[model samples]
Target: MQLFGGRKQDEALAKREEQVRKLETECRTLQTSLEDTRELVRHLDQDRELLLGALEHLRPGMDVQPQAQVLLDVCFKPLGLACFYVALADWDQDLLRFVLYHEGGRFRNHPSRRLSDRSGLSERVLAGRRPVYIRTLEEGRAAGSLLTAAEQATGLIPHSWYGVPLGRGSRPSGLVSFQSFQTDAFSEGRRRVMDALTGLLSICMDGPPTPQGR
Candidate 1:
């Protein structure tokens, strides 16, 4: 009888241990879900602020410089972008000229490169007249050559990047790109927001022949 009692107690203890392990697993899953919910809420707030700022600051009649600055301000922190660039297709010279190349809290001078250059992802977007999104630089490199020697030299290479063609012509007139240092930073929702933002940008970018070296 004592042996049987001992066996039953051991069985009960094992069952309790199993229940405790299951509960711990459930708690971890709940914690992760809560964190994801918080992140989504943060992104929604940022999107709201970005759209409000765009409405107030971005106007179709604005010049390239002012509009570009407004765009950078509204987008940089809200979208958590590490770099943003606006490169127009100069088909006449077969070049892609960057009007705005912003990074590290300021703009940088970007040299014009031939449209045929595989390194400039902007050219690929223009050529395809579509969007290109890479979750990592390794993915981009695997798809094709990722960056030019000059761009690589900057030492600010992004972990994730996305770009969309601008304008409705047979070939896009330009491209607007956003870069992030964190993998999977730009979700489908964020990409959709960027698409809307680019529409406003296209309106602002319209009107003038983008002069060389802007």
Candidate 2:
């Protein structure tokens, strides 16, 4: 009888040891998962801070447009943007028209051609009030039917493009566009960053700039 009791006790101890091992394995897995989640959160937080900081440097003021252009040059030029344009809303045409254009490295100019009331690219963007990032000119050709006639007329071929609408509420007031000579230059992350930059631009355009002559 004593031998039988001892055997039962040994069996129970073995079962408890196995259970403890299983629980420990599960605990380790849970810990690893928790650590991974924390790391992801940290990375996301860092990215958010970086974006906010960049936006802060471009915020609206008397000097906003020039500062914004500088910010855009620093941020987008390295990413392959050859030209950048900002179009203000034209109520008569119900479209955005280029108000400021930055060409070369530091020259601020205006667009020679009008983009308002166009059908394909600018029209689609103004209608949707969303950002359009094209990796290839072929994609733009397919997506921007409004620009076909103009492109053909001017003998211009856009190889790559990115555009973001600027506005408040449902009525978009303007657009910011980036053009590249290379295909597939803009990525989803770049689009998001451009969206953030445009948001700051909208705020800058809300009030007229103070005059210099006083």
Task: Say which candidate scores most in lDDT.
Answer: 1
Q: lDDT per residue, candidate 1, 169-192, as tens digits? A: 776878889999898789899998
In candidate 2, stretches whose alpha carbon ends up further than 4 angstroms from where it belongs are: 1-53, 93-95, 103-116, 145-157, 207-214
Per-prediction TM-score to the true structure, in the order listed: 0.76, 0.58
Model 2 per-residue lDDT tens digits across residues 112-148: 3344546556656776778777778778778853343
Q: What is the lDDT of residue 81 in candidate 2?
A: 70
Error of 1 at 179 (Å): 2.0
Model 2: how far is 100 from its true place, Å? 2.0
Model 1 sits at a Cα RMSD from the real structure of: 6.1
